[model samples]
Target: MLQIEKKKCFVELGKFLNQFSLEENSKNETVLHNDLFFDSFVDLIHLSQSHNGWFTPEQVYHSVQSWAKALQEENLNQWLSNYDFSKVQPKTVGLILAGNIPLVGFHDFLSVLISGHKVLVKTSSNDQHLIKFLAQYLIAVNSEIENFITFTDGKLENFDAVIATGSNNTARYFEFYFKDKPSIIRKNRNSVAVLTGEERREDLVQLGEDIFRYFGLGCRNVSKLFVPKDYDFQPFFQAIYEYKDVIFYEKYSNNYDYNKAVFLMSNFKLLDNEFLTLKEDTSYASPISSVFYEFYENIEDLRKQLENDAEQIQCVVSKNAIPKSIPFGKTQQPELWDYADNVDTLEFLLQI
Candidate 1:
């Protein structure tokens, strides 16, 4: 299939996704293959949580809407405009997906096919259904796509290159295993926020979205905070109170109760807001239902520190407090070009 054909299929898939949302899921008869796919996709979205406890209907709908916005013709064109794929030869690219958040590996899947390569995907056990279902929709829209996509139940084979996402330990295993293949192997990384004393209440509230979205499971979620020395926590707490209902989710509440007890038993001082706990720590990866914070004495020194530790950080949320920092609540809505781990996935695929 031509590159334009691939783009058209994805655009149709996006339109199919655009019909469903948390508040409503009315079917639109105008979408292609609606009679076959529209109601089934809704059922899958509702059943997503049963497949994986974290993939609630709200989270799944959010993921779907984000993609619906991204896969428009203009967005795809703008993203692909800078890259040349005319000389590309088709090859099988193996994708090892991460299920930390809904559709976490869709970008890699999209990249391979859009670049005129066949994809052999090993879906993360935690996220087996959603992508496969979408692949069926894509094939329905354009039968040619069936030649380009495949999902593996066992070990990956007959692939020229690979893209894998996993923990720091699994990354090492991927490096040794795919040493000869052109690859992008991702590892554990966390996002952080830099807060001066000048943030507005609205900024901090949006910052709560960065913290609690996906229950803080995604690499892009802000798990740590860099606050100025003696910065008051009262306002931050007040602003984030809007997300207190997150605790009503049974799994999150269990984490909150358990982690809080563990901290209290260890005699560590905690700043608690009933639903979430704040602790003084120097780590980037914080536990769920909790955020780790560190006090910095100087902005310049902290900036240099983050620069040196860039490999360990996914994003920095701030109000121009740091260079190239993402806005407060926008971490989860990454653009197509916002390559994970700063690795250019398309460039890697084109080379292979």
Candidate 2:
């Protein structure tokens, strides 16, 4: 009965969001315009800025709507059909939210809520507002959410299952404490891009948005690039230089200065402009100083390199052919179906 109710509720929520997406003050429009609505949202985030990271309100709204659509009834049903929930029922689920990116915990939150389990959330101080706002909104939508969710500022205990997201060090702590329980302990990760010689200048510019938006703070942001050995770096750099205004922000400036100092100390080479620092790393998620670019001589070698680094990457963006399972972000926006930490959250929900 609970499962049936959740499915109906989600379907209704999804429909409402579809309508919400059409409003004049829709989330995307506000982001694209960088207008008054965006300013208000930025203010809300500023409240949480004492820590390292805070989300723009546009990021919060888009993520919520996306989760509603991705975890819709039919998808949930398909995932649940193969599992037995009788054993996982009424579990107390604990979730640790990551503040490195906005709405990083939404998928886990949806999983616990739709599973009909009680949720205990430990929110990152940097991102407490959106969850608090949504908690209120959920109650408005179906008041009964109050019965299933609770926010905590301290330690939680006796939870049957845990889904925690944090740095690699923090994940170790969670593993030690919850190893005996059913858990998904997520470690730090970032995404990457594999560029073939065929990428057009327009696509490269949009790809810069993937790298520069949010000041390169999110897990979805591409920190590393894989390019064909013969591909020239100047054109790629030129395409992204148009967004140089993005680097003018004080926060980004600080990172750039700090990284630039470190680069000078280390005697590393880089080509910099107003917005980005371009360096080379064979890894994912570059620092504020620059993104890492590596050149591969052949497609087969590139594929081999990507396969080796698959465990470290959350997603891979490419203009060339990509696997069906890998998702693509349209411009700087992510659809609801993109799961963070590479977890299939809706599938986890149905089993509980």
Candidate 3:
């Protein structure tokens, strides 16, 4: 129902996002409403780090660039192609967003609006500014979208259905609170990488980006590694040395110092570089500045284990060693169709 005009509006917004990069904020004359929004967006990106220490300008720009590529006309068409939206009755769907990373809830926002549904958003306090600013730009591009978007501060009351993302404890609370409504409640999940000893150093180096991006705050960041028994970790430690500068960030350094001291106090053996620590653990969720690794006995056994534990994982980074796995360093670059928790968000929106 919103395929024609609204699609173009989003594409224009994409063009706007593309203009700003870490290297430079270049203005393209063709982009709509640049006079009103461009300078302000740049200011916001710089000011974001002050608002939330984890939201560095580089991370915010990376998120912006990713969304820009996803909002291309061809990408949008491809994403919406399979769904038949002929009968989508517009309803005000409420969203409870997470704030682990910058713009983490934008996908849910886009899904609801693009599927011809009104969205009532309750943004996490940690991430309150960027989404609202983006919404303003969308309204500027296409005035019709104004009625379709609303950001609420109080309890979400006037919505037909809900989608909420949070930690596992909060997920239980959401399930109880939204019991009377149709809802999708997401819980904590982590990503892991499967490594073979035969891999080149370049591969491990790329995996460092997967580990260090967004200070490993995003769910897509690889928090654990599955390695063959007796796998020499020298290559990994050597390769990830390129990311050693990550320790320069005060927040990351604080986490590293705190987590490393705690591990030392617990008498756990750690393979530590100056910046990152590798611990042998069975848990999927590792703290920031650290990655937990487990030695797998066999490929088949590892694959089966991953399948059994798929619900707790957001991504499996591998070189085709596992089915449905993404490549190293690519967990953060998900395509539009790659839904969080493997749930079809657009499908849910259309049905709602």
TM-score against truth, every candidate: 0.99, 0.82, 0.99
Per-residue lDDT for 1-352 in model 1, tens only? 9999999999999899999999999788889999998889999999999999999898999999999999988999999999999999999999999998999999999999999999999999999999999999999999989999999989999999999999999999999999999889999999999999899999999999999989999999999999998999999999999999999999899999999999999999999999999999999999999999999999999999999999999999999999999999999999999999888888988788
Off by over 4 Å in 3: none
Index of the highest-lDDT prediction: 1
Better model by TM-score: candidate 1 vs candidate 2: 1
lDDT of each: 0.95, 0.67, 0.94
Ranking by lDDT: 1, 3, 2
Count of backbone collisions within predicted model 3: 0
lDDT for position 182 in model 2: 78
Q: Model 3: how far is 213 from its true place, Å?
A: 0.5
Clashing pairs in 2: 66-336, 223-285, 223-286, 277-290, 281-292
Q: On a 0 to 100 scale, what is the lDDT of residue 127 in model 2? A: 74
lDDT of 3 at 56: 92
Model 1 segments beyond 4 Å from truth?
none
Over all chains combined, what TM-score does candidate 1 have?
0.99
